[model samples]
Each structure stands twice: as structure tokens, then as C-alpha cells.
Target: MIGLVLAAGAGRRLRPHTDTLPKALVPVDGDLSVLDLTLRNFSEIGLTEAAVVVGYRKEAVYARKDELQAAYGLKLTLIDNDRAEEWNNAYSLWCARDVLKQGAVLANGDTVHPVSVERTLLDSRGGGRRIILALDTAKRLADEEMKVIAADGRGVRQITKLMDPAAATGEYIGVTLIEPEAAEALADALKATFERDPDLYYEDGYQELVDRGFRIDVAPIGDVPWVEIDNHDDLARGREIACLY
Candidate 1:
């Protein structure tokens, strides 16, 4: 399966330190940065190819391509999103349209998790074009975290960033497997959303899928040690979870 590493973000939450460096290059664990450890984990999980979507400070990320390749001996694809500032995660996903295949592993560069996720997705044997790993919000969720209300049995669901304070349910772990058809449909949905509302976030695309009756399955990511490194506080927590390696 192909891997899509989403490194395209201005990292507005991570200031000062990120003013000069990309968030993906920031140190997470003892020695390895978020990008470094993330790739290592994917390599171990039987990944054949990887595409890193770089945007802000992409030069820094592009410069290290050779080093990472030499270290892992893996073929890596780098896609740039010059307009990352105007859009959200959905735009980044759109930037890699040329690189995305039939079944692609979608990962957020700012977050890190165990690579066993490959096996988890494989076990589900999804029939849809896109399926996301649904983390248990009960485990722990924040106001800024993305959440979903999945349908019964099938992974199909309506996903969104928290809209209500009291309706907390499931969290969205960044790991996702998007089938080519799903990716295309997602691109279409995003295009429509943007045409109407230029300020729309990528989450809108997922909601569109549900509206159109696309069976976007939700695979349970229960109890998996995953962390979204938004700042220094998250960095420490990520290290603790990284120790699971």
C-alpha cells in the first residue's frame, strides 16, 4: 500500500519554534523528530512507498529527502502545497492527487502512532474508497480534536470537528486509508465545498461523503497510543507514547 505523509500545514498553533522550522521536523521523542520516527514506524509496517505532502517550510523537508532515503532505503514521494495557507487538510490531500493510488495510507505529519496500524486497516478489508480509523473519544478528547458519529456495523459515518460540548462521542485518529475512487470523490466534494464556501475546512468533504450515501467505514482505533503534537505540552505526551516503540 502507498503511504501519504501529510506535512503540509502552517502550524499556526506551534509558533516561534515553528517560525523557522517545519512542525514535522521538530523533536518529539529523545532524538527523533516527528517525521523521522513516523517514517521508521511505517517502514517496519511493510510499506512499499511513501509520499510526503510538504507545504510550510517545505524547503527544509525537501532537503532531507536523501538522508531519510539512505537511512531507510525506501522510495519517498514529495508533493508540495504552495497554497497550504489558504486551505486546510483537505487541500493538502488534493495536492497529492497525482501520487495517490487505489489504496493509500493517509497520515498526518504532526501526529505519531505505532505502525501496527497497517495490520489494523488490512484486517478490516474495507470495500469503500475511503475508511478512517475511529479513535475512542472516551479514552480522551479535546475540544479541538475531530470526532465522528459512525453508523452500525459498517465503517460508514458522519465525521466532524466537535460542534457541541455535550455531544462528545468518538475521536478521529489521523491514520486513514483512502481508496482511489474515494479520493477522487473526496476531491470532487472538496471542490464543490470550496466553490460555494472558500473558507471551508477539509472536514466538510467527509460530511459530503455521508450526505451522498458513501459508505465511509470507521475502524476502531481503541486504546492505541496516538498523539497529535500541537505544541510543547503535546510533545511531552507524545514522547511518553513513543516509548511504546
Candidate 2:
């Protein structure tokens, strides 16, 4: 399996920092960007090749592609998402459909988490599971967070940000393991998700999968130190915890 990163979105809330670089390039540790951490985590987990979906100042990534590859000791494949500025991540993810077909450990480029999160997903693989998401059962959920409702054996029944926080079992920590068998269907689901509403998140695509009777397993990353960097506050929080990772 290869590592997949969805790093196409333009974080408008992040302004000047994102004006030239994508959100993934925003540094959390001294000189290590969020993407750097992601690649490092992938490397640590034995995934020596990765595909990154890039847009919204994609040139910045192109400029640093070789440097990032050399630093991470991995091969980098940059996928282009032309509509990143106009659409949501459902499309960004779909852009890497071919790569996903090979199976992948997918991490949102803006998330800063330790290698443990990836390890948890990897450890939970098999037993006929096609898709496994890293769910954080410990974090207190808010309406803004992408919430999930999953049962022990039944797997995830619902995954969305619009759901009531009180009803959610956990928050999806922006990491997933996709088995090769599930990729085609997932790609189709993602296509339908974005075509229906360009503003919908890739999580919505997972919802689509559930709606179609796909069993998406959830692996709880117990009490992990992680942050999804959205705005400046998240970036600050990321910095505090990134060093710990």
C-alpha cells in the first residue's frame, strides 16, 4: 500500500501563509511542515511511496517535491486537483483514484498526528475489512468536528459533520486505510458525492459508501495527541503537540 495525502484545499482562513503555499505546507515544527510530518509518519510505517493531491498554489509543492522526497526517503507522486479552489476534498480525493486502487493509508495533509494513528489503522487491517478509519473516541466533539456513529461489529453507520455531537461515537481523525478491493467503489462514491454537491467533504463520500451497504470499520486511536489544522488557533495547537510526536 502507498501513502495518500489530500492536500489540495486552499485554506482561506489561513490567509498570507496559504496565499503562496497550500495548508499542508504550513509549518508546525520549526522547519517541518504538516506535509513533512505526514511523510515522516508514512515512512516510519514502512510506506516508502506516497501520492499527494496538490492544488491551490500547487507550484509550491512542485518546488519542494525533490527536497521532501529526499528528506522522507520515499518516492513522491503529485496528483493535480484543478478544482481545489472551487470545490471540496471529495474531488481532491477522487483525483487520486488510480493511486487508491493500489490500496493506501490516507491522511489529510492538514492533520498533525503521531505515527501511532497510522499504526493503529494498519494494525486493524484484515478480517475482510476494506476501509478502516482512525476514530478518536477520547476527544470531546463539537458540531464543527466530523463525527461518527459506529457499533462494535456493525461498523460505521454514520459519518458527517452535521450530525448532533451528542449522538456521535467519535470523531474521524482524518486518517484511513483503504484496501485495494474497496478503491473502485470508493472512487465512484467520491465522484457521486462531489457531483451532487461540490461543497461536500470527502467524509460525505464515506457516508455514501455506508448508504450503499459498505462496512467501514473504525479503529479507535486511544487518547492520542493530534490536531487538524484549519485556522490559526488549530495551527497553534498543532505546534504545541507536533514536537511531542
**Candidate 1: 10-residue stretch with minimal lDDT:** 126-135
Worst 10-residue stretch by lDDT in candidate 2?
11-20
Query: What is the clash count of model 1?
Result: 4
Q: Which regions of candidate 1 fall more than 4 Å away from where they truly are?
A: 127-130, 165-168
In candidate 2, stretches whose alpha carbon ends up further than 4 angstroms from where it belongs are none
TM-score of candidate 2 versus the correct structure, residues matched by position: 0.99
lDDT of 2 at 237: 96
Candidate 2 per-residue lDDT, tens place, 75-159, comes to 9999999999999999999999999889999999999999999999999998999999999999999989999999989999999
TM-score of each: 0.90, 0.99
Clashing pairs in 2: none
